[model samples]
Target: MKNYNLRSTDEHLNNLTSWLPNQTVSERLANTGFNIKYFEKLPSVINHCLPLLSALLERYDSRERCFIFNGIKCGFFLEDVYYCTGLPVDGVEVTGVVKSNNDEKEEICRMYLGVSGLLTKGKISLKNLRDRFINAEDTDYYTRAYLLYVIGSFIVPDKTGRSVDVMFLEQLKDIDKTGTFAWGAALLAHLHVELETASESSLAGHSYSLMIWAFLHIPKLLKLLPNTGRKGPDEFPLLVQWTNWLSLDLKNNFHKNLKSKFSDILDNLKDEDIVWQPYKNLQNLPNDHPQHRENFLCRTVLICYNEVVYHRPDLCPKQYGIDKPEYSGVRKEIAIYKKQRKLSGEIDWSKYTSEKGKVDYSKYIQEWKHRSESLLKEALGVEEHSGPTLSSTPSSIGNVRYDCSNTHFEDDEPEVEPLQPPPSEDATPRTQADASPKTPDDGHGSGGEEITWNTFYLAFSGQAHHSTG
Candidate 1:
């Protein structure tokens, strides 16, 4: 397999470090719910870690949508995005196309960059954006421009790697409302889409989250590097604690020994080797902090403008201390899902949701609403131990990895319902009311399949039949 290289605009991010010390800028960023204090240190803290990333990508199972490290399932989730970057997890879905007219685009260019018609070419140069805003006055314009830079450069960059998309300017127009966008969800969705095709020669999207997640969960991996000297539990948006943690020599050592060491660690990994709940006792966050919100259980389609990806938290039940289930039939379900995506073609999710009602996520919505019931008995404050112990051996059948390429689909597999647009913007949550019944009239009949947390775990544990189109 070819080694993948990470692509980011960290240089542009570094150039904007001058604004990090501006009190006004910091206040404005905090007001928007963004944690920019650690940003200045990113240039030094962020290294390619090519070998580590390449090894991880090599083990990524697209069908299961996570990496199988020594038989333990783990992947980036929305909560990770929130903890790592401190981006808001709930708010208006950051979707919809860039509808700014040429005049409006030029006006934004003129107002922000002191240059007219720069966006006529479709994007603004990162250098021009940085140079203009780096020393500009400490006002709303500066804050908006800085946010645009963060979005285009760090949050959801395009393939160019040297320019910021003018389209994001629409969301930044109202600086105060910027905090209301579900930035964390969008970042996670973008990263998920990137990971699906990561086997290629190059991988893009915010890889910092992936690196930090590995360090947080795998103690052995972090031991290979120099100590970060973090004295206590990290604050919310844990990325801040990682600043200036790696030295030049340490990075070189990683490039030299990362692959061999990483393999050895995973090869001999034990049940206790993984840190299942790193954030459970964060010193700065209260038990009821919004950072601990259960939105992580909401398995739904994460929409970032025209891009859409599935957020399947149910696959990694152990992350929540839940008992692993024995059987699952989601392999066929995911295969049919891919086939449906192909049949549907590219959908502008924002337009699709508005024109046809919201995509039917009722199945996962109902599951998320009752997440507490799925927790392990111990997690519910019971004294006696029940369910299987963490160290209990998994079924041997779960160890056999199926070749997705050889799997075939049959017509008897469960049928997924087509989209049914709602007539109005009703406030009701899309639960049972929006779901199609498994009746013969609905075409699925009584034998129609329903996916639950247990079934998803089957797919993750490699116990499900590996079949895809």
Candidate 2:
């Protein structure tokens, strides 16, 4: 892993550090004393991370549950979690569950859940954190928004299904109304994109489930946005990110082998039982937005099931075309979705327009300009800004070493063989959608096999299958 300077003074870093703790990173790390390698319980990790957490609350001046934490605007927390333990940031066994038999791995998992617990429901209410800093005149709303997001990302509940806490749903709605945390929404959306890309079966399946749950509930936030009429500032970038990930995943066959397992699960479900709660909850959203989420889900399922229906037929008896007949090529639905959304792989933020806030994208616009200049320099073979990338020596934070060189770059980068160029805007469209399950004599041929609701639920919830893909 290449280690970038943590103290580098640049337009981006300056903007970020402006909202960080008053002290330097090293000073803050020392104040936290988070140098333990193995924690037997989650409380231990919480106790250690509290200083860092407190510093964040002190920076944001609002007594509220919502804040944003773009990994860029704020220093990343997952890496710190990894620093506390030797565990890979990709996490042990992707499911993120530590095996009971392995004391060390189990401890790591406990620590992760524990840290999340502290942020969301720890004894010190995040409300209290806000009160402490609420009087600061120089409070950075962007930082506050990002901080709230950091806390929310860890807000996943223990149960899956209809058992989600009512408080959480209400909290999501309240936060969404604020409209200051679009960056958080965008970050969670990006997580969903990452999950789809890494959908291969592995321990990572558990990580995927956590993200899926986040996606499932995000509509609660989306539905509550103020009447801006336009999409939030983060929406288009997220869409572009999602499409690029899918395009790249296809090229690398990331979802190829695992596609059959989804079919196996889907084929066992009965037509009437395919309704997922997440899809049903979006009823209050504008027709276009909710439909888009549904389309994404259906398209993803089609990709997994290796079944497609070119166009959703009106004559189909089923509520969703997912369960009915209509034959076309695999991944065809996804292709059409990409076309309708105009999700080109490249995101030109310069062309982005949103009415969310005053100076809504001033910071991002600056960053984009910087990036463009860097590219121009690279093109011209200029070395004006060149310098050696300095990495930090290994230092034990908790149990794991914080050596910058050991970062999880390999785990994160997509493994693509013979990398393919991103698809051009004018690239020829592919074949149409494949057939979904359907009964006979429906004009279209009978959809091959039917899948039971129980089967799909089991696979999706990680009860029947351990892998994600």
Q: lDDT (CA) for every model shown?
A: 0.47, 0.19
List of clashing residue pairs for candidate 1: 357-421, 357-422
Clash number by candidate, in order: 2, 31
lDDT, candidate 2, 253-366, per-residue tens: 122323333223322333233322222322222222321222211111110010111111111112221222222222211111110111122222223222322211233333
Cα displacement (angstroms), candidate 2, residue 221, comes to 25
Q: What is the lDDT of residue 320 in candidate 1?
A: 56
Best by lDDT: 1
lDDT at 237, model 2: 15
Root-mean-square deviation per candidate? 13.6, 24.5
